[model samples]
Target: MDWSKTKTIFILAFLILDIYLAMEFFELQDKSDYAIIQEATIEERLAAEGIEYPDDLPDDINNSFYITAKSKDFTIEEVAKLKDQTIELPNVNFEEDQSFRTLNMILDKPFPLPDVNTESKITQFLNDNIISGELYHYWYTDEEMNSIICIQSYNSRTIFQSKDDHIGMVVLHLNEDNEIISYEQSMLEQIKEVEEKEAAITALKAIEALYNKNYLSSNSQVVKIEYGYYTHSPLSNQQILAPTWHLTVEKEDEESEDFYVNALEGDVLQLTE
Candidate 1:
């Protein structure tokens, strides 16, 4: 046997192995950088302080959307009855709109609301005036110096994410004086359990879907991802709450835009004003 030749062969084999391992290491590092960037996003608003990040995230991030066809349905009467048991607002002018069978209430004059408000005050107001309030969870508050908007959602138990889940079918609007200037509500008669509780598209996949479709720019960062229900036709008597993924993307300019994707299916649900 040629000892020198065998030693040279072994050296060459080890060099190839080292190159392969180095390539794998760089790939893993790239993935780690992506995950770190994703986790660094500051969550300005949250339903809960400590939210568990999804464990099933992929090592490589790309633009792909998972889709499914599962959904639950309810009847018009059931929805109407949900509103029938609502509590009337005191000292407020209220009118029921024919479309979506929603109640639109307005104050005769603008009342004062505090710059800062408490959840209990908001919940008490809803508990006092909305029968469907018990079913909804307090989601978030959008406040200007003079006004605050408290958002609530129905069926918080099934919420998979915190982003927009609580903005279900009802929204409460208030002024700086803590006065309820107006409120808008839409109620679903029932929330029936379907066989499956799983979502086909992971939160990361939904963001990828947006990025692939050019709905999100590379410079934008995702601030929040939540599980919720979104209504496309608010005026329709037969309104359906599509299980949705609400992704709030913050741009380089510090402005944010909300992209709502269907949780079951991968379609982006757009809200019409």
Candidate 2:
């Protein structure tokens, strides 16, 4: 056996292995650097355009999925609980599935709401007067409609609704005197999280997506950001909802506008009939 030749062969093999590993390490480092550069570039560009967002933008990755649910039906037994309201359920299918999408009510006497700190008053009213009120959270008031909107939620997450579509919500009508008048409610039932839990984009990424799509206006301030679900299948009987990012932008002397972005795909979403 040639002892010297064997030793030389072993050294050559180890030398080749070391070179390969070093090259792999450098490649990974380069890729990481490129990612950081790309993110920094986005930040700089946004500043240049005068687009303002909150300083505490979330970068945490979360898991979510597509869900399926149907509108809930209101039974005669449920409405019987209301003590001081004239009730109507025009959308109920009593014969078969007993499913409904809307509930209407008119207060027997106008209930006055206070001018200051009306939030606690509203919460008390819901618990005392409405059915399944625990499942909903206060949303916003629509001055044009003269209504106060409360959104239905599940598992600490809210179900989003557009102006055109009324699902999983309660609309409380208010008269000029800040008194309760008539109202309508909609709800969802049999909510099943269907697809596998998938990764969702962060708040920053969603904002970037809106800017890239030209859905965001220049010199606008993002006043609100919310994580919720939106129905992608509006016409289907069993609707499928997607995890969404809702961004509200406000400009001086302009009406605030909402833009929803699909969290998984980074696409700006709009509701269709």
Candidate 3:
């Protein structure tokens, strides 16, 4: 064998191997350093005030982390407990106007008649009945223009067998071209002034029936209750103050349960059970 030739070949092979190993080592080192920096940044931020980050972080970590970090006063266990207490709206019927056909009809055709005709009918109806209030107009866009002409009567009264009740709202809907589509009348009668206390009491009673029936536990505690007016066209002008109630109930496993309940006419509208 030629010693020089053999030595040269071995040296070149060793150099090539060394270069490959160096590249691999640098790649691994770069990856390790990147991971360390990321970890250190997270730890430093979380440990600044002894704040504990959530163990099972959500995929959207930036938003969740911000919320958790801002609520540093809460411990990890406290946050877990809070999460457990949050109620899921699994049984709520959130579908408003479940009959899509009704909605589709209004959207499909050009508004049937002129807005003036529909508005006049509504105004005359209110005036003849001596319903005192303001009238407003609204428009919606489907494939074509749709309009809603509304008449809202503030406070009024009626007598049914010597019983006096408050009537608070009246609404009318007109199509895009100002054609009458629908009207709604509220059942509350002769309301003098809309007071929160009166509305809350009404809401509580309405909610209680639903709670006892199927929406909530009989022993559920009503933590908060609020009531206010809600207007919906294609329904009635008689707007009722919708009452919302927040409740906490005890589960069989001793977990605290939280949920919201909307009660109207002895029926639960939206309930998280």
Best model number under TM-score: 2
lDDT of 2 by residue, 1-273 (tens): 999999999999999999999999999999999999987898787788888888987555567787888877777668777889977655546566353457788889987889988978888888888888878878998888888988888787788886457778888899899998877887888999877788898888888998888766678788888888886546535668888888887765566777788888888974443
> How do the residues 1-273 of candidate 3 rate in per-residue lDDT, one tens digit apiece?
899999999999999999999999999999999999865463453344333323432121111000000001112232233211221223435353221111111122222444356545545544533223232222212233232323232221111100011132333445445644444332333333332332233443433444455544433333333332322211232333333333344433445543434423334443322
lDDT of 1 by residue, 1-273 (tens): 999999999999999999999999999999999888766542321112232234443233122222122222322344355432333344544354223344555645544444465666666666756545675545555555333334444445223222233223456666655677666564445444443455457677677667657766545667777765565544233334566677777776777777787767788854322
Misplaced by over 4 Å in model 3 are 1-130, 135-176, 179-187, 192-242, 245-273
Number of the top lDDT candidate: 2
Q: Which ten residues in a row have the lowest lDDT in candidate 2?
A: 91-100
RMSD (CA, Å), candidate 3 to true, equals 25.4
What would the TM-scores of all predictions be?
A: 0.52, 0.80, 0.20
Model 1 regions more than 4 Å off: 1-100, 105-117, 137-152, 157-176, 193-198, 270-273
RMSD of 1: 10.4
lDDT of each: 0.53, 0.80, 0.35
lDDT of 1 at 197: 56
Judged by whole-model lDDT over C-alpha atoms, candidate 1 comes out at: 0.53
